[model samples]
Target: MSRIWDRMSLNFLSEDISVKSMKRSKQKTNVLLISAVCLSLSACGEFSYKRGASANDFQQEKKSCATQHKNDADVDACLANSGWIVVSADKPLFAEATTTDNKMPVQMTSDDKVIAEKPVDPLELIAVGSWWKTGAAPNALIADSEQCVTELGEAHQTRNNMSLVTRGLVGCMSAKGWFALKK
Candidate 1:
């Protein structure tokens, strides 16, 4: 217990803040948080890409979501350039993407390989007991769900935000294309 506690520190909670500093922090935090959320959501989205198989064949796979963007502004610019319609007062914006390469930023592995699946965000599920409520989750995919929860726990042992952890779990399950079936 001491060893575990030794690795943990809550210094941020103790920091003093000036009114000006607090305002700046709030502004910066909001921007960063929104950007982070946008990127995270995009990671789970279906994007248009070359569709094929055979490992190297590499066409469209369900995991090929365009999640990586250099910045929020960059994404906006790309969207505008593509004229993909940002928001319409009328009509749903989402459609099954057909064009190859949605033109958004592409996340790559350390080996420079394009990441097909959006990596799970443990921070999104830091406090969830399991990926899904028992009996609500699909039995066939529970193994992956366990792996997801364990990964979240191990990755952020000190972090304990229930909502974030749950979101992370959802992201993990989404990345793996695991859908919880209705009981």
Candidate 2:
């Protein structure tokens, strides 16, 4: 009778340990699943081409431009001139550092006052916007951009002077109407 009682108690304790272990495993799995979901949601966002501008204005201008220009570059220039700016939900639309007083921000210079920053080129803005939207390889874009800088002729590349020629490349793409769509 003593031997049987001892065996039964041992089996019950082992079963309880197994159940506790299983619960812990499930808890760990649930935590990991929740973390993964949060990470994915954070990465998700959309792109837009307006900040201070109205959507109705964009649509109307876009419709007119579509009818007017056969070339995408021409259309883009028209939109840009009309004050359409590229913006992303994930990033600040107007990230320009400014003082609270809203004065023209400038960098100290040796000479007379000069504006420290110029408005970022629309083409370059679109490049960043498109990257997040399309998830395309930047190397591929740079490869495609080689043709754009070919006209410049014979830039000496050195270890310290490695240049992407971004302006020329983005300009070429903009001329081709290769704007990135948001995901």
Candidate 3:
């Protein structure tokens, strides 16, 4: 079974406060009820999973944060203070990062400083948005990206050969005049 079920089973076993004395049918009902409650409570968690700024940015930020924070909370705090924002569809904590036209200027605040003049590149701007199909091959995308990044003279690469590109790489591809096309 999955970790969720395992954890729920453990919880049910541990909360054997009244289970031992109950009849078998009553125990099954109790287990189901407890499981439902546990699932519901878990689903109600306030904290949402976060995707850090960009591929390049996250790597850099994580390297910076690693020295200071051994705990996940501390690391998250450090990243937040450093201006990293969360990008998740299941739970949205803030507004989308970019406007319709990425090249247009938008205000980006970092370390209490407002950057109003910098233009958001199409890739960076659309990183949280959409363009191409989601089922693209990793190798093809990486090959295309390498060609584009080299052309733009930007140094951004995937860490651990992961599926997604760094935000900087997206911008690099855009700079090289490549838009992610749908198949």
Write the residue-wise lDDT of candidate 2 on 68-182 in tens digits: 8989678766776775653434555422212235576566668786545565442232223332213546665554445545643234111111222233344454454444332
Q: Which 10-residue window of candidate 2 scores lowest in summed lDDT?
A: 156-165
Residue-wise lDDT of candidate 3 within 1-183, one digit each (tens)? 599999998899877845665667797898999999677545644332224445677777778898889997788678667756433325543223244654665566675675466765534422232223345664656677677557645545444442344556655555444443211
Cα distance off (Å), candidate 1, residue 10: 82
| Residue 69 error, candidate 2, Å | 17
9 Cα displacement, candidate 2 (Å): 0.4
In candidate 3, stretches whose alpha carbon ends up further than 4 angstroms from where it belongs are: 1-135, 160-168, 172-183
Error of 3 at 134 (Å): 4.1
Q: Could you tell me the TM-score of candidate 2? A: 0.27
Task: Kindly indicate the candidate among 2 and 3 with the higher lDDT.
Answer: 3
C-alpha TM-scores of all predictions:
0.21, 0.27, 0.26
TM-score of 1: 0.21
What's the best-to-worst order under lDDT?
3, 2, 1
Assess each prediction's global lDDT (C-alpha) against the native.
Answer: 0.45, 0.52, 0.54
Minimal lDDT window, size 10, model 3:
125-134
lDDT string for model 1 (20-131, tens) is: 6898999999999999978854564422212132433222221132254556455544543442223322322322112245467767678785547665443543322223
